[model samples]
Target: MPKMLCRCGKVVGLGEIPSSNQWMIISDTMITDEDWDDNGLNMSDFYKKMDIVVKCPECKRLYIYSKGFGNEPEVYNLEE
Candidate 1:
């Protein structure tokens, strides 16, 4: 499991599976007819091209993955 420190000083992931905080984001344009065809689809390959987002359970802050900026996630704090 991958773990990272949240800006709120809470530890995200914490070596455990995230039931709700983690999500996979796929662009609508990325999906093709091949993906819908069971015989042609490869989930592993599809997942690699997707982006990930994790919400800090403690502070409700969002950590969004940016493909252009290397591995570090871009942080977004919730607005009141």
Candidate 2:
């Protein structure tokens, strides 16, 4: 499971990733070839990416989460 820390230092559990229906697609025209080449990503690659909206229960702050369309490690550690 993944956890997120609020600015107030409150710990929040994000549980499992949401389903594909919850995903938001990025428009290809929003990204330029130069930007894609610099990042080694193309418009086609953007389809695999998504943004998840999360809210901190403690402070009510909203957060946008993404995995950069890659298999990466957790950004936050679990509390002992």
Candidate 3:
């Protein structure tokens, strides 16, 4: 599990955080042209930009964790 610091100086584990309403699981194959046109992005581009976001319960801050964006799976606090 990864640990993240909140904006209020509270350290919390990524896994322990409540993600019921703070996560999005996007699939490349499920993206249609309408969705692409709505977001002004292509499916291929979206596929490479998939990521997971978790929110800090303490300060209501967002923490984005990259999954397949050609980067390491690291936690990023929005406040930072």
Model 3 misplacement above 4 A: 16-22, 25-30, 33-49, 66-80
Q: Kindly list the per-residue Cα lDDT of model 3 for residues 1-80, writing each as its tens digit.
A: 45655667877664544545256556667667777577656656664556666566676666565653244444544444
**Model 1 local distance difference test score:** 0.76
lDDT of each: 0.76, 0.53, 0.58
Model 2 local distance difference test score: 0.53
Per-residue lDDT tens digits of candidate 1, residues 1-80? 36777888988773556447777788899888777877857778987888877889998987778462258887789788
Could you tell me the lDDT of residue 45 within candidate 2? 61
| Candidate 2 C-alpha error for residue 44, in Å | 17
Specify the highest-TM-score model's number. Answer: 1
Off by over 4 Å in 2: 16-50, 66-80
Off by over 4 Å in 1: 17-20, 68-70
lDDT of 2 by residue, 1-80 (tens): 36656677987675556532122545577666776577656545665554554566666565544654233322333354
Pairs in steric clash, model 2: none
Better of 1 and 3 by lDDT: 1
Best by lDDT: 1
